[model samples]
Target: MKNLGRVTPATALVLESLLSADSVWGLQIVKDTGKKPGTVYPILERLEAAGWVQGEWETSEERKGPRRRYYRLLADARPLARDFVRAQRSKASSAVRPTPAFNEGGWSAV
Candidate 1:
């Protein structure tokens, strides 16, 4: 499997959602993570490109909506997904702090 270079917070959220699901379509993931299509699609493409996930188009004849692309995490990548989530969580926890408000003149450190 290709190693992922950087896992952004948004990407982490997408990956986290996949962990609980057997397989999911693009829009379902967007709803599950509350991420916009613009954000989620690119992340899905990245994951598919990295070989961590596989995607296929649904071919059922009874489908009612637009053909959905289903994405699934490769069996071998689940451990990596777990590790990535843990790392992202640790990184997020460490970076959590109150944001400094802007002053009248310009942006302030406080």
Candidate 2:
């Protein structure tokens, strides 16, 4: 798999969603991540381009809507994706600062 460059929070969410299942369609991913279609599709494309994901158009004709592109996290790239997710989570947690308690009189830094 090639280098994925920058892994944004949106990309991390997409990776987490993909990790939850064997394969997922684009719309499902959008819904799962609660991210806009514009945000999710490009990430999927990037993942596919980076060789971390493989996307195949659904062949079954039983469904009534447009053909869905299902994306799967390539087995070889799973470890890398997981490590990225973990690192993003670690950064997010560490970057969070506790909010100061609210005061009825006025706002205080402490």
Highest-lDDT candidate: 2
Could you tell me the lDDT of residue 54 within candidate 2? Answer: 99
Highest TM-score model number: 2
RMSD of each: 4.9, 2.8
Flag regions of model 1 displaced more than 4 Å: 97-110
Per-residue lDDT tens digits of candidate 2, residues 1-110? 89988899899999999999999999999999999999999999999999999999999999998999999999998998898899889999989987776799786657
Cα lDDT computed for each candidate against the true fold: 0.90, 0.93
Candidate 2 residue 103 Cα shift, in angstroms, is 8.9
Residue 88 error, candidate 2, Å:
1.1
lDDT of 1 at 60: 93
lDDT of candidate 1 over 1-110, digit per residue (tens): 88888888888889998897889988999998999999999999989999989999999979797898999999998998988889999999988877778888987656
List clashing residue pairs in candidate 2: none
